[model samples]
Target: MNITINRNSETPIYLQIAGTIKNMIEKNELVKGYKLPGERQLASELGVHRNTVVKAYGELVSEGLLTASRQAPKGYFVQSAVNSWNFNNRFFPLEKMIRYHYNEREKRFQEIFNDSVDKGYISFGGIVMDKKVNPAGDMGSIVKHMLQFDEDGEIMSFYHDDSERLKKNICHILAAENMYVNAKNVQIVAETNQALYYLMTLYLSEGDSVIVEEPIVPDNASIFRNGGLNMVTVPMEADGMDMDKLEMQIKKHKPKFIYTMPNFHNPTGAVMSLSKRERLLEIAQRYGVPIIEEDSQRDFRYTQERLPSLYSLDQYKSVVYVDSFTLTFPYGVKVGYVVGPYDLVDMLGRLITMTETFVSNMGAYMISEYIERGFFAEHTKRLAAYYSQKLDLLCSQLDQIEQKGITYQKPQGGILLWCTLDENINERKLFLAAKEKGVLMMPGFLFYPYGYQGRGHIRLCFSNVSDQEIVDGVRLLGEAIDQVKTKENCDE
Candidate 1:
């Protein structure tokens, strides 16, 4: 097997390998039923990591060009006639497809999740609040009254009155976080991700740079990619993102803005320290760069005192705050808001009006009424207590299996737990095996911008699962992980 690899090329080595193999299969150089070199052997011959070869083979497998053998042969075998479709057809040609740079793997993950749901798999996958803790009984009454009696035409009218009321309610909520802002500085968007999309469209252009954490929120990563922005990622430390490296990257990239989840960050559950937040704001103010702060998971805290948000500490008004009611309320109510300078808020508000005509007006009115009636505070307080018990159950179950090369830090307050696996464990295999055993989980690689580097981690969201399901799911998860480890050891 003589394959040429250019070390200097911009294309990744795994991609280059997959491309070469794909070309060979298309030209019939490797026919159906042919067996390729094993991952370790190919990696040894090519002077690359075994994981790189694994990814190359996985790419072909995903394209239906290869199949794995369970008996006799132990490597991937070529499949029959996989690439029959034409890439340059007359109608709906591939060359003229939409410009959104969505990764095919994300679609694959969604397919897996849907299939798991249909199969009744115990779900530890989605970031949703438990239905048992939902305030539907209270919200139902508010929704019913709004629809029955359109008092002041708040629900039926296209006027901005309902929107204004929602912003005013959001301002009241932010006051608890120590962020003092009026309704004029608030803009209602559909959710946090949409808020980010709007801000990116308004501030950034093609090829403009932005800085974010290495293991960024997956949706935000997709948004940045689709918007044609250059992403500069800084590594995450236990306390938060490494400020020293962040400053260095800022000096180098001069990004349009910095995006951060300062409170209860997604995937990692790391809370940024007060000192780091102050330094971050100071640096951004000095450099004339704005910071986009996402605080979606702040209200789910189980322990520790709540710290002041960057929006509150910013004397120069350099932080644009974004949050949503997805977790605080039920999942379907996708109401979110952005707080910034009045000019920016006004522009975002106008954009929302132009694009959506109205941002969930009925839902907004319901939430505003909920806040005014003191239901919002009552619901959030109950949620913290409810989710605290769930988190404790998950941590205790995980504690029993710590010796199995899995470890995690108990988060001070968040809905998810971030666990680190032993270096030899493969998270993709673990996820597949767990799914096969009627449990679903997220692989850490999905959170990373580049694959293979995040093979040693996994995130489990315990918010939606029941206590019994948590116990059973952890048991199955541990078995699946052991099976993968045993197989890897045998192969070696």
Candidate 2:
């Protein structure tokens, strides 16, 4: 996004703009079909007339360097086709041409960011739970026990539907939360992300509208978008999503569903009040719109009193509850489940048959055994104690630093702490300086679906690091903040 212009240059401003953009395209800085900045934005950024930037874009169009796709708002897309008018060259199978494109872009970005990850860095950027409390040895013991006891034929055959043992165990555990559900409503999936994607496929079509709470999980946002759904966002407040605004938007858009996380909202760590949860369910029932409640973090409470989930509060059966073990268990296990009305669950089961037949049965077996023996409860109890201390230590260290303008809430439950700084502070600048100091944090915008609207917010996860690491990381984060602010003053 960095574009520089020399106002005193003898060359025309429009040509300079065109030349710079063309060079970026030629250098592969802008990938194929990359959306170019709007003309007004580019012009205002460079302190030039709008028409000059428009003329630059026109120049590119004349040279066949850019092409407009049917997707509007992104006026010009950088094209690989030079003579796009050529019949044979332009004709492409719709399915195959776009195949693997988004994945490639994702891989490209992954590589770009992986360079910042260092062996010694104190990283608070990721949501993955710490492996120290991961119960690997306990899980291994359970798997060995399963191998000794489970009949080989049962292991080989996909005999029973949807891991009945695991579902039964899940139901038993969830009864404490008042989520009384039979096994028929549960279907195991590989992961929560996959579950959300499948549900998106079942519920949404191209250009269908979906109501989302602003600053949601980015992967969820991406899944909704890739499924060809238009996102309408409602503001999220400290208590929960703004209900009045949600009702207004729901009436306006009549979205396929109201997607939300009522407990420990990602990157925010705010819990929805009981009254608000009831109100949300009432609104959904009134609108006849199903709610997709990602309740993964409901079990991760550290200190705060647990709130009843949207699913538990819903008397109308309008909430589609999704959760996964990845946040609490090992990543490779990748096991999750979805619970809803019988018809919806049955449809989801059939959809899984069409795509991924079943999740790792061996992993599911281990989880089931772990839960059956009461080890899962033990593990979570220990995790809650471990993370509660870590969260307190992190917040305490930040407070001790006397770092002015940094404000955060010590979360009642969940892995992350959302810190908001004064509007004068730049999260991006702070991120770079923190990275340089071997401390990594997730920039706030990664939680949002729209543009870079998360300026002063940053998310720091406490579940993945040791106590010493948290202390050191928070101290270094304060240093990085001071460093960023000092640099900002110098620049001014």
Candidate 3:
């Protein structure tokens, strides 16, 4: 038996030996029932301690590659190669796996989001609005009222186009935001993201470039990536996506379409100003590029006047608008809709037909009845008030930590707050350390794509936690930051 060891290598001796032996087994040089040299004899030949060889043999034995037997000349021999085969035996390159190839950040993101909290751990991971503010009673009342008109499953008919009544109600909702569109141009989707995915599949072929604003919610870029499209990011300023830098990138890449969330933008909660919206439309129209506007959170605005949607401003029919009430009603209702030019809406209708997937007509009927009868407007008012109070309380709590070198913008309206820490504190280290103290907030790294790191920044969602939990969570978060800072000072 020939075995080589590199003393200068950082890999442990046992690992190196096990790896070499495993490779030999995979290449068939060491078939089943092949005998390994005696630990003492192998150590003598390799000029290493017998214990090192013992540990190596011990690892393989534990892995079921070898079994104790007197059948061999010594005592043990290879047993079953099939039993030793692992998940990596597939030999497929990781880059070819769509679920993980484009980004592993999403897996890490899921880990943080899905962590089961201890009895009292404060979790701020999900973006769902606080249930206390959700219009559960109103929805219950609506559902109870809708059941009266069921007429033996008549509303559940098979030969259906997107509900004409629901589509018109959505049109009226958009009209309130100054975006006037006919019901024929609206395609109801189970969720807003479904609209985005369908649009990406319709417009972007593999390797096509799509312009996106940076520091967005992960789903925004992830859907485009899954469609085999490349993303060109335009940095977001306080007002919105930087138009000057955007024009520069436009000149360079000339992407197929631009995607943005103008009102109460994700993670950052930065609302675009009216002027920025106008300029955004002008630039897209000038370049002959269409825009996909995710207008999901605009209804939750707390401070300023609502901005006109890009779809409303486009006379050239250059924008596709997506909206959902998933926040106001929470995840229970998946009602959302897409509005665009007649042709694009027709294409989406065809795609839905091909997939044989349609939005829940029952969910549509309930939401439509709620909105038409004016329950939704009143429900939103109540939600705005509830979330506004929480927002104020959270800002007050954050103010208490201003002296600790943690500062954040008090979002005008929306559930998330973007915070920046002192240059000395590492946000990544603070995230893990904070979890130990029973408080959770997302590290900003998950929001950015590969090759971009959101250092010294953390995003906290006020949408999900309670008033008391917010205080304790932020206080614990502050303590975590201080612990990091204090340790750094002592090390210095």
Best by TM-score: 1
Note the Cα lDDT for every prediction shown.
Answer: 0.78, 0.73, 0.74
Model 1 C-alpha lDDT per residue in residues 245-315, reported as the tens digit of each score: 78766765667788999877888899999999999988887667788999999898877688889999989
TM-scores, all candidates, are: 0.78, 0.75, 0.75
Clashing pairs in 2: none
lDDT of model 2, residue 233 = 80
The Cα RMSD of model 1 versus the native structure comes to: 12.0
lDDT (Cα, tens digit) per residue for candidate 3, span 1-492: 756664422245676677677556645679888888888888888777888888888878886777766563666687654432111111111121133244666666666766623335687765755556666446666666555445665544322333788999888887878878899899888888888888877766676678998886776677877777778788788999999878766765667788998887887888888899999888877776778999887777786576677777788778888988788766477888899878888988888888888677777777777787787888888877878888889889989988887888777888778887765666667888898998777877677774332235778877767778988988998898888763232211
The CA lDDT at 84 in model 1 is: 31
TM-score of 2: 0.75
lDDT of 2: 0.73
Ranking by lDDT: 1, 3, 2
Badly placed stretches (over 4 Å) of model 3 are 1-102, 116-120, 136-141, 148-162, 453-455, 486-492
Tens digit of per-residue lDDT, candidate 2, span 1-492: 666553322235677677677657755688777998787887778777888888888888886778765565558889652222211111111110111124432333343235324446787876656777876446656655565344544453332333888888889888987889999999889888888777877766676678988777666676767776778787788999999878766665657778898888886888888889989988877767788998887777865477788888888778889998887777478899999988888988888888756687776777887777788888888878888888888888888865556888777888889988765566667777988888878766455554333236778877668788888898888888777663222211
TM-score ranking, best first: 1, 2, 3
Q: Residue 428 in model 1: shift from native, Å?
A: 0.6
